[model samples]
Target: MVDGGGAIQRTTAQFEGPRERLLCLGPAALRTDELLACIMQSGNGKQSVYEISTKLLQYVGGVYALADIDVAELLSVPGIGRAKALQIAAAVELGRRIVHKPSDQRLQIRTADDAATYVMDRMRYLKKEHFVTLLLDTKHRLIGEDTSSIGSLDASIVHPREVFRFAIRRSASAILCVHNHPSGDPSPSSEDIAVTRRLEEAGRVLGIEVLDHIVIGDGRYVSLRAAGYMDN
Candidate 1:
């Protein structure tokens, strides 16, 4: 009997669990850690790729933050080589672009969520505020999207004359003003409200309807029209 003295015990078969399930199934079935492992491909001989991935996620703050990281920063991780970093960065850019594309032909802006979904991916990643105007034809189809201004975080100046000039040039029947708030809050500020009002009044005189002014945050947004700020 080895009750008092320590004994070397023979190990049984390894228990198959979540981690094994992740490796056996695929990246799609895996958690964030498992997905990172697929990107890493391999790790130092001392640790498995999944173990290395878990440590990297902890260092980077999480998967969401990891998505925002550049190649240089990702390469800084112990197990991530330059090649792996580039692969991850490329995957992120692909995902970002895919989210911005609308699969269907319908261009209707039926709700605030619809407007936000259209602009969030494009604007959220931008470092500076971009004031863009989406010109729509009478059928609510997108004619064009133009960047009116790019400026510092606080605000981007917009002139009604310049805005209408583009609208008239494009022969757009209606317009949707879109701008990003880098602060990641979709709530409209006083200045935001003021700008929307100015654009609405200008559109009234120009015979071009201003359908909405949308403010895009990181993953959220606000539609001035839907909030009853614009007079339809």
Candidate 2:
């Protein structure tokens, strides 16, 4: 039983065993709860925040589920007081923002696969469909990314005007539409094709070229343009 003081008192023989050392190896390799406990460095007389974070992860299902959780839901977990909940929320948000932010100043989307690789790590785990637009300059460098819609498993409501609105505002020369299928199938549905066609035609008139439409699935993705849908 570790107390709320940064002190590991009363080490059981079981804990001192080689198996335990192998499991609780280093701070860098600790599980989410252990890492959180390291940050917290203490418990609240009963259990450590590490233990609480472990319980919270279990209650929420896992780390991915926890990412989808809101502040209220996170706060409801034991030992994850308001401050800790906010901290977790903030950390997740920071990670999200980092992923969305363009990394390389010279990053350019040369192909559908390139675009997919950029957003895959962020969108693949989403529980719901999210329609995002990547705005690009004439050189194909990413200027911005916008979430046009979010919806249930079947569909996400989006408007061509909404998609281009950000492009126009940012003076982007082209755009690539990307979305995630929580069902883990990257195949484009009839509705997906229709939406892409609509956006393409709209972009034609607006002088903002529709570069491609990429559908993200579980560890896989499909580019409508690369599949010959856009050219046809």
Q: Which lDDT values do the candidates have, in the order given?
A: 0.77, 0.82
lDDT for each residue of candidate 1 in 1-232, tens digit (9 for 90 to 100)? 2445686332223213444555456557768876766666776788888788898888877766654577998889877778778877887788876866655775776555766677776677665678889888887777777888887856888888867788899999988889988778878888889889999899989999988899888777888877777775
Candidate 2 on 1-232: residue-level lDDT in tens?
Answer: 5679876655656454333544556545456665555444456679855577678778887777655677998878877777777777887888788766755575799988889999898888887799999999999998888999988866888889889999999999999999999888999998998999999999999999999999999899999998878954
Off by over 4 Å in 2: 1-26, 38-48, 76-81, 97-104
Off by over 4 Å in 1: 1-23, 44-52, 55-60, 66-81, 99-101, 111-113, 117-135, 143-173, 179-184, 197-209, 216-221, 226-232
Report the alpha-carbon TM-score of model 2 versus the true structure: 0.79
Q: What is the lDDT of candidate 1?
A: 0.77
Query: Highest TM-score, which number?
Result: 2
TM-score of each: 0.59, 0.79
- Cα deviation of 96, candidate 2, in Å: 3.8
Q: What's the distance in Å from true for residue 206, model 1?
A: 7.8
